[model samples]
Target: MKTTFVSLALFLAVVAQMVASMAVITNPVSSTKGKGGKKLSVVWNDDGKSPKISDWGGVNVFLAVGSQNVQYKLQQLGSNLPVTQTKGSWKVDPSIGANSKSYFIRMEGTKLGSDGNPPMAFSARFELSNMSGQFNSTVQNAANGKEGAAPSSSTTGSSGSSSTSSASSSSTSSTGLSGAASSSKSSSASSSSSTTSGVAPIYLNSALVTVGAIAAGVAAFV
Candidate 1:
């Protein structure tokens, strides 16, 4: 009976620790300054660098404010060039050139064809505003099962013959907790399932916890 009691106590303690760890992993806080001098606090997964894909299917990421378009090429501004392949919180600062009232960002993912040409397979757009203190990205929101508009191509005047894509299909705007919260949750789950190396630590930790629980139960019975 004494052994059983000790085993049960150990099991409970392990369970408590597992719960605490999960809570910390799922909720992360980050803060960044907007170009307009506003401070924004965001909760994200902090999954490290953006993903890289095949050169044939390379992705283009950009931020636009009015006529100014800022392009981020892999490893530029902390993006790992191939952002379309990874599923996690990828940090990006949308500021480019002078401060602006609003920012529009987009991602274009392409796939190479048999004819040696690449065509767009996926595209997304996001809009950020200083007044709202929140950002709304079409792909991020849609991954959480929310309905939004699709991305479209646009031309920027300031960026000399550079074409910019915008995702302005949805009429609705999202608030902080509503849009971003869903994004974090969905992205974390996706990251855990999609890539083996990306979420290896999280999976290992969870497995250890589960194994410990099973051992404790078996020991109690013995």
Candidate 2:
């Protein structure tokens, strides 16, 4: 009888653990300041998934910052194809509270024909963005999954280009958290640098958010 009771308790405990693991915590995430007084940076994991940059024809990505309308473009490599503009515009605003940015993407390409010529296919464009911290966090938890015994991170593999993890300082404030939150640019810079080795980091000077891409059949001018 004791053995059976122990077995039942173990089963119940396992079930409780599983439920807790699935619980969603959408509580307001208090932003934190960086160790230094520098601004927060943003990073992108563009290399791992979905229509990777290398898969398409010549591709260029750019970001537009501030009122000066200053823009910087990431150079394109790979196959040579015509630069075609796609429909619609991709825009995002990082200044808004949690997740307030959208993403814009374009693709282009051509294939060699049997006649020793080249055949081209129309380019494709994709744009996606999401707000709502609860929704975004839920999706992220689902997609990222549990690292150890913890719950998942996110569901939507693509959480827009602006979504980034933050680094916090040890110093605490009256809020019982770190000091003032770092700027988004600092977070972006850290993310981009860590993800891309041997590559220069890009700085975002203003609040504006714009990313441009150009391929054989698809091109986005931000």
**Could you say which candidate leads in TM-score?**
1
How do the residues 87-125 of candidate 1 rate in per-residue lDDT, one tens digit apiece?
A: 333444322122222233322334433322222111111
Taking the tens digit of each residue's C-alpha lDDT, what string does model 2 give over 1-222? 011111333333322322222111111111211111122222112222323323334422222111101111111212243233222222332221133221111122333222221211111112222321111222223112211111111111111121122223222111111111212222333332111111111221122211222232111121
Question: Cα lDDT of all candidates, in order?
Answer: 0.23, 0.20
Q: What TM-score would every model get versus the actual structure?
A: 0.23, 0.16
lDDT (Cα) of model 1: 0.23
Top model number, lDDT: 1
Scanning candidate 1 in windows of ten residues, the lowest lDDT window is: 195-204
